[model samples]
Target: MIRTLIFLASLFFINICSAEESKPVTLNVIKTSITVDGKKSEVYDIVQDNGQEGYEGVKGQNFDVLLKNKTNVPVAIHWHGLILPNNQDGVAYITQLPIPPGKSQHYFFPLVQSGTYWMHSHYKLFEQQLMSAPLIINNPNDLYPNYKSITVMLQDFSFTSPDKIFANLKKSSKEKMASMHMDHDMNMSEPDLNDVDYDAFLANRHTLSKPEIIQVSARQKIRLRVINASAATNFWVNTGKLEGALIAVDGNNIKPIKNHKFQVAIAQRLDILLSIPNKKGTYPILAQVEGTKKQTGILLVTPDTKIVLPSKLATSDAPALNDDQERQIHPLNSVVTKPVTKTLHYTLEGNMSDYVWTINKEIWPHVTPLKISKGDQVEMVYTNNSGMSHPMHLHGHVFQVTRIDGKPITNGPLHDTILVMPHSSKTIVFNADNPGIWPMHCHVLYHMEAGMMTTTNYTNYPAPSFYTKMISPQK
Candidate 1:
C-alpha cells in the first residue's frame, strides 16, 4: 500500500506540472497614445496583463500566445523569428485569418530555439503604427548573474497615417517617372535613399530630446539586444568610444566580431556584449540613419553620473549598409549541410521612378510560387537589379548566406532576414523540413506594400484544416 501511494503521489505531481505548463500567456491588442515631440499620437500596442510592452521567457518554457484583440479593427501578430507551425504564423491571408475585433486567438507552438527575437503585426500597414514588441528568449545556461541585458527597439515615426503615406508615395512616383523621361542626362550611379522622410527617429519610442536612460553600476558587464523595427530606414549603431563584441545576428550565434559600430538593416537584430569602464560616466548608444544625419538613441549611466545631452543629428551622414558585415559573420556552431537538390534564381527588380518592387519582375498575389518538397535542400539566388537595397525576409525557416556576388562562403551566419544591396547578388540555402506555404518578402514596409512579396510552396502538401475552412476550394 505504501509503494502504491508513493507512485500515485509522483503521478499527481507530474500532472500538476503539465497543467501549469499548458496555461497560455495572454497578450492584449489595444489602441494607445504616445507623445512624440509634444504631440499625442494614437498607435496600436501589444502588451501583457502587467502592461509590459512585450513578452520574455526562458528557453524550454512552453505556453500559447493568447492574443486578445480589444481594438475596433482586426489584427494579426507574427512572432517574428520563431520557427513555429505554419497555421499559427499570424500572417493575415497566407496562413490564417485575422482575429476580428473583440475576438481572441490562441497560437500554440513549442519553442525549439532561443535567442533575441520580436513580434509584430503581419496585417495591412499596422506595423508602421507601432504594433511591435521585443520577444526575448533567454537560455538559463547562458545567463550571467553579473551581466545586465537591455533591449533597444528602433523605429521611424510619422504623424501621417499609413494609408495617406502610401497614397503620397504613389503620387510622387508618377511625377518622378514623368520627370525622368524628360531628362536623359540624370546620373544613375547614386542609389536611392530615404523614400519617406520620417518626422522623428525613436529608440524605445523616445527621441533623443528625451531618451530612455538606463542605470548601470561601475564596471558592470552589459548585453545589448538592438532590434531594427524601422519601416523604411537602415541605421548604424554607434557605441561611441566603447568597443563591443558582436556575438549574434538575427537570434543565431556567430563568431564574435569586435567593433565600435555595426549596421542593422530593417527587421534585423544585433546582440552586442560590452564591459563598462570602472569610472562614473555616461555612454550614449546612438542609432544614426543611413545616408542621413538624423539620429536617436538611449543613454547608459552609472549612479550619480552626469547625463550629457546628445544632438538629434550627427555631424556627417552615416554610410549606407553593405554586405561587408554580412561577409564577416560565420556561425559559431556549424550547421549540418545537405546536398542542395533545388536551385532557383530571382532578380530583385524595381525602380524609384515608378516605385514598384517585385521578385523576378512579377508582382505579389500574382507571382508564381517557388515550389519545393519536404526534406529537400534548397538554394535561392537573389540578384538586386534595383537602385535600392532590399532586406529579404523568409518565414517558417532559417537560412544561411551561402554566397555573395558568385563567391561561395563556408559557415556563413544563419539568418531569417538578409539584406541584398543595390546591384548586388546574394544566395541563401536551407533545408525544406517544414511543410507549408511560406511568405518571402522585403522587410521594408513600403517596399512590401508596393508588391515585393512571394511565397515558397511545399509540393503535395495538403492545406491546413483551418485554412480550408476559412476559404472555399477553387472550382
Candidate 2:
C-alpha cells in the first residue's frame, strides 16, 4: 500500500513539472512613442515582462506567445524566419484570424532551430509604424563565445501614414506611365526599384543625428547582428575604418569572409565579426540606403574618446547587389545527397504601373498553392520576370539556393529568404519535413499588400477550421 501511494505521488509530481514547462511567454503589442533626432513620433512596439524590449529563448524549448494587443486596430505577429508550426505563423487571414482591437491571442510552438530571427506585425502597414523587434534563439554551444554581441535593427521611418504613401505611389506611377505613352497593363514593363522616398533612416531606433553609442574596449572582438527591417529600402552596410568578416546572413552561419561592405535587402539579416583596433578611438558603422544620399548608423567608442557624428555619406549612384557574395556562403554542415522527387517553376510578375504584384500571373485569393508531400525533396525555380527585385520569403521552412540562372551551386547556404534579381532565375531545394499550409511571399511590405503572395501546402493535410472559415475557396 505504501509503494502504491509513492507511485501516485511521483505521477502527481510529474504532472506539476509538465505544467510549469508549458507556461507561455506573454508579449504585449503596444501603442507607444519614441523620440528620433530630437523629434517625437507615435509608433508601435512590442513589450514583454513588464515592458522589456525584446524576446529571447534557448534552443529546443517550447514558446507559447500570448500576444496582448493594446492598440485599437487588429494586429497579428509573424515569427519571421522561425520554422515553427503553421498555426503559429500569424498571417491574419491565412493562419488564424487577426487579434481584434484591444484583444489577445495565444500562439504556442516549439523552437526547433536556433539562430537570429525577428517578429513583426503581419497586418496591413502596421510593421511600418515600428512594430518589429528581434527574436533571438541561442544555442548552448555558441561558436563565438568570447565575442560580445550587438543587434542593429535597420528601419525606414516617415511621418506620413503607410496607406497614404502607397496610394500616392499608385497615383504617381499612373501619371508617369501616361506621360510616357505606356500601356496601363502591368505585364508590359518593369517596375522601378524604389517608389516612396522616406524622411529618415534609423539604426537601433535612432537616426544618424542621434545614433546609439556602444562602449567597447580596444582590441575587443565584436559580433554585430544587423537586421534590415525597412518596408521598401535596401541598404549597403559599411564598417568605416574597421575591416569586418562576414560570418552569417539571415541568421545562418557560413564560412567567414573578409569584406568592407555588404548589401542587406529588406527583411534580411547580416552577422559581421570585427576585431577592434588596439588604438583608442571612436568608429562609425554606417548603413547607407541604396540610390540615395540618406544614411543612418551607430558609433563604437572606447574609453576616453569623444564621440563625433560623421557627416552624411555620399554615393554617386545606387549600389547594386550581386550573387557573388551569396555564392561564397555555404552551409556549415555538409549537405547530404538526396534524390529530388519534385520540381516546381514559378514566375514573379509585377509592374509599378498598376501597383499589383502576382505569382505566376495570379493574385493570392485566385492563386494555386504549390503542393508537396511530407518527407519529399522539393526543388523550386523562381524566375523573376518583373523589373524590380523580389526578396521571396517562405514560412515554416529553410531552403538552399541550389542553382542560379541554370547553373548548379555546389554547397549553398540555407536561408528562409532569397532575393531574386530582375530578369534572373534562382532555384532552391529543400526537404518537406514539416507538414502544414505555409505562406510564401515577398518581404517587401507594399508589394505583399498588393498581392505578391502564395502558399505551400502538404498534400492531404487538413487545414485548421479557422483557416477554412476565414479564407474563401479561390476556385
Candidate 3:
C-alpha cells in the first residue's frame, strides 16, 4: 500500500507538469505601427502566436504582457478577463516589478475565457493610446447559437499628442466638466461645470473619412463584440440603421436590453445580436460618441448588391450625462450581510492637479491592507469622495456588484472590474477564494498607479493546488 501511494503521487506530479507544458505558448516583444489618416505612428506590442500551426490557431490563444523596460518607467499590462498568478496581474509596481523602459518584461497566461476580453497597456492612462486588442478565448464547449463572430475594438483618438493632455490634467485637476446643485441648503447655486476632453475618438483605430463597416447578408444573426478602448472618454454606441439586442457586458453574459441608443462607458463592453432582414442594397451601422464629432465603425449589410460608401454622418453638439440615463440607484439593504466573513471599505479619495489618485486617500506601494481568510465571502465598498470617475478592479477574482450606495443590485453579473462614477458609491461582493496579496484598485490604470488602490491577502485558506485554492470556493 505504501509503494502504491508513492507511485500515485509521482504520476500526479508528472501529469500536472506535462499538461502545463502542452498548453501552447509563444511570446514576442516588438514595435508595430499604424498609419493614422496617412500619417504613420508606432506603438509597442507583446504578441502571442498561439502555436496551433493551423487555421485552428487563428481561432484564439491567451497571452501575457511583459514590461520590457530598462529606464524603469514602470510598464504593466492588465489581463482584463483572465485568471492568473497574483504577481502577473499586470499592474506596474503592484502585481510585480514594473518594466523600465530599457528592461524587458513579459506576461504569461492563457486565453481560454472565450466571449469578449481585451488587453491593454496598464501604464498610466497610456492605455488610451497603446496595445489594445480583441482577446478572444475560444470556447471549446460552446453550446450557444453558432454564428460568425466579429470582434470590434473601439477607440477615442486625437490629432493632439497624448503627452500634452497628460500635462494639462496634471496641471489642472479641478478643470470642471459640468456640475449641478443636488443640494439646496442655501449654497445651491450652479456649481462649476466644464465638459472637456483632450482627443478625438475612433472605432478600430480609424476615424470617419472612411470608417470600418461590417458586412452582412439578409436573414443572418451576427455576433457583434464591441470594446471601448479609450483612455478617458465615454461613448454612445448606436446603429444608424440596425437595431440590436444588448446581450453581454465586460465578457459576462447579461439579460439583453433593446435600445436604439445606449451609453458605453470607458473600459466597458457590449455584445449585440442582430438578425438582418432581407433588404436590397446596403445599410450602414454607426457608433458615435456623444461629446466628440469623431466616430468610427459602421456596419454595411447588403442583399445581393454592391457596397456604397457612406457619406460622413452629420455631427451633433456634445451632450452631457442626462439625469434619466445617468440614474444612479443606491443600495436598498436587500443584501443580507454574509455572516462575519470579511469586509473592507475604502473611501476612494484623490486629486488631479499633481496627478495623484488614491483609495481612502492613500496611493499604492502604501495601500489599505485587507487580510482575508481563504473562502471568506468578501464585501468591499468603494466610496468615491473624489470628483473624477474611477473604474475599480480587483485582481484574480470575479465579484457581483451587490449595492450602489447601500442599494442592492440584485441581478448584477459577476465581474472583475466595476466602474465607480465620480462622487458615487458602489459596493461589491465576492468570495475571497483566491489566496494572495492581490491588488484591488481602480481599473483606470493611471488612477491606480497614482493612488486609488488596495490589497486583499488570503493566507493558506486551503485548497489542493495554488491555482484552484485561489479561485475555487471551498465550502
The top-ranked prediction according to TM-score is 1
Supply candidate 2's per-residue lDDT for 433.
85
lDDT of each: 0.87, 0.84, 0.60
- Residues 291-340, candidate 2: write the lDDT tens digits: 77678889999999988897665555546666877788887863335978
Return the candidate ranking by lDDT, descending: 1, 2, 3
Model 1 misplaced regions, further than 4 Å: 1-20, 143-146, 188-191, 351-353, 464-475
Residues 1-475 of candidate 3 have per-residue lDDT tens digits of 9999999999999999888756544433345666666666665455655521101222244453433442234566666656666666765544554565666655565554556766676656556555556565556665346766766667765555566665665555444321212333445233122223644456666665656666677777777777777666666676656677766666666666667665666676667776677775565555665544545565555655876765444467445333232232222222233653777887887654366776666666554366788768888888878666666767777677776767766545556666676678888787765576676767654465455666676775332243333232212
Q: How many residue-pair clashes does candidate 1 contain?
A: 0
Separate clash counts for every candidate: 0, 0, 45
Badly placed stretches (over 4 Å) of model 2 are 1-23, 182-190, 334-336, 469-475
The superposed Cα distance between candidate 1 and the true structure at residue 50, in angstroms, equals 0.2
- Tell how far residue 359 is off in model 3, in angstroms: 1.2
Instruction: Report how far residue 87 has shifted in candidate 3, in Å.
Output: 3.1
Q: Which residue pairs show collisions in model 1?
A: none
